[model samples]
Target: MREFCDSISSYVSKQLKFSNISIYQKLNVVMSNKVYDLQYKCQLDDNVLVVAVCYFTQYLQTQQINKISAALNVFSTCAVLASKYIDDDSFQSEFFSDKLQIESETLSQLEMHVCQALQYNFALEQNQLVNIQQQLDEILVNNSNTPKMSFLEE
Candidate 1:
């Protein structure tokens, strides 16, 4: 889990050219922390996190996010969409915006942009979600011994 988060943080940091690495760290913290929180808070299924990570990676690759704020918008929007698609209960933009410390209007706009970028294809087959979970599990197992810090703790 930590490795996956680190790779995403490095990728976003480089892509956005954040002058302060702390921005990327904060983004990583917010994403990891909130994803876990939503899993319990919304009574979301475990697959929701897998789908959210997949959507986040896809969004990062396809979108041109030039700032940390843009990256947060994308991440937060993806989380909301993923939960809606994967879980019985879904959170509103205001809920996620408060968690991410962003404005609700910005999150709504980003959600629209993300939906358009994805061509409105929000469906994830069961097998696809399973595969993503498997891959992430393998990563966690391989890096099990490595000591790491939660970005949230920093």
Candidate 2:
């Protein structure tokens, strides 16, 4: 998992040249916080987080490297979509926008972009989910400095 993040960091740095390492660190912190907030506030299952990670990985695999803002938008949209996919009573875009502190219109646009990037396909095989969950577990275990949550725990 650490290797995955390191490779992504290296790729983004070499290809995008958008910002320094500190910016990526900050983005990780912010995204982590937002995912936690989404879970807590929406009472979403932790599978949402796992699925969001999968969606983000899929988005990265599909798209070219871009600016930090674009990357963040895609990530945020992934979380929103994951929640909606797993939770029938998921919150709407306005709710996500408020929780994420992003403008509603911007969030909507990003959501559309992510949906298109995904080619409207959101299915994940059981094995894929298991693999992603394992990677997420390793990431959480290795990064003890980050506040821990049992994302896959019942």
Candidate 3:
């Protein structure tokens, strides 16, 4: 995933002739260094963030869109999530404006598209599966001293 992220960042840097690589590097640093309190956020770990960015970028490339403002918005969301999860910092709206070289108006539109693409589902991920398993285990332990809660069979 690290390699993939690096590759995508590199590709974007070349294609856009914009300084997106530095933004990606900063995002990596933030994820590795910060800390957060919330658990239900949509932040990706490094691997998944990279994959998501690559997925979006590849989609844009296929469409032959010279403008990357939209892709950067999606990338910002993924990067912010990664940073929040790994580093524990909330993603500021300013980060989108400053890092991706996008203006406020364009960022707003991109944000809307990103939300639509994600179906407003911000808490679904592999890590959530772990959390769900933990909750289920706690339920089992709490029920151990009582009659079991059984699933009905057909």
Candidate 4:
């Protein structure tokens, strides 16, 4: 999902005539804050949180420092959004409050800030899944045989 989100952000930045590397650099700066400490905070055992971090990094790449606080909110929202897709259960305000050691109301407010910063552009596509699935399908040739471990070994 993060790969997909990053791809979309890259496309948008190219469309906007901005430097993608600069956006990545700026994200690094914004993420140096305590609020961005969620990188090591989520309890999930999956890669969703990592993906959320990538999304946040890309989103931060495109935003200004004056918007960093709001961008962080959007990062949280994207994390929840990505969780909905990658995790089995949906994350709610209570879930965030319990997981991130914050209050439910505070999570709600942060979500609001994220929405405002993104202007609600939360429907970004994650094409990595589709691309990988398509490639696997082609290799399988619609046969019932399962794919080998070679793909994973790489």
Among the numbered candidates, top lDDT falls to 2
- Whole-model lDDT per candidate: 0.62, 0.67, 0.43, 0.48
Best by TM-score: 2
- For each candidate in turn, the TM-score is 0.65, 0.74, 0.39, 0.43
Q: What is the per-residue lDDT of model 1 for residues 2-23, given as tens digits with 9 covering 90 to 100?
A: 4555434443344455567787
Clashing pairs in 3: 34-87, 35-87, 35-88, 36-88, 43-81
Number of colliding residue pairs in each model: 0, 0, 5, 2
Per-residue lDDT over 36-82 for candidate 3, one digit per residue giving the tens place of the 0 to 100 score:
10111333343444334433444344344333443445566545543
Error of 3 at 112 (Å): 1.7
Which 10-residue window of candidate 4 scores lowest in summed lDDT? Answer: 145-154
Candidate 2: pairs in clash: none
Candidate 4 per-residue lDDT over residues 101-122, each given as its tens digit: 5577877776666556556654
Error of 1 at 103 (Å): 1.0
> What residue runs in model 4 are displaced by over 4 Å at the alpha carbon?
1-42, 65-77, 126-154
Clashing pairs in 4: 73-114, 74-114
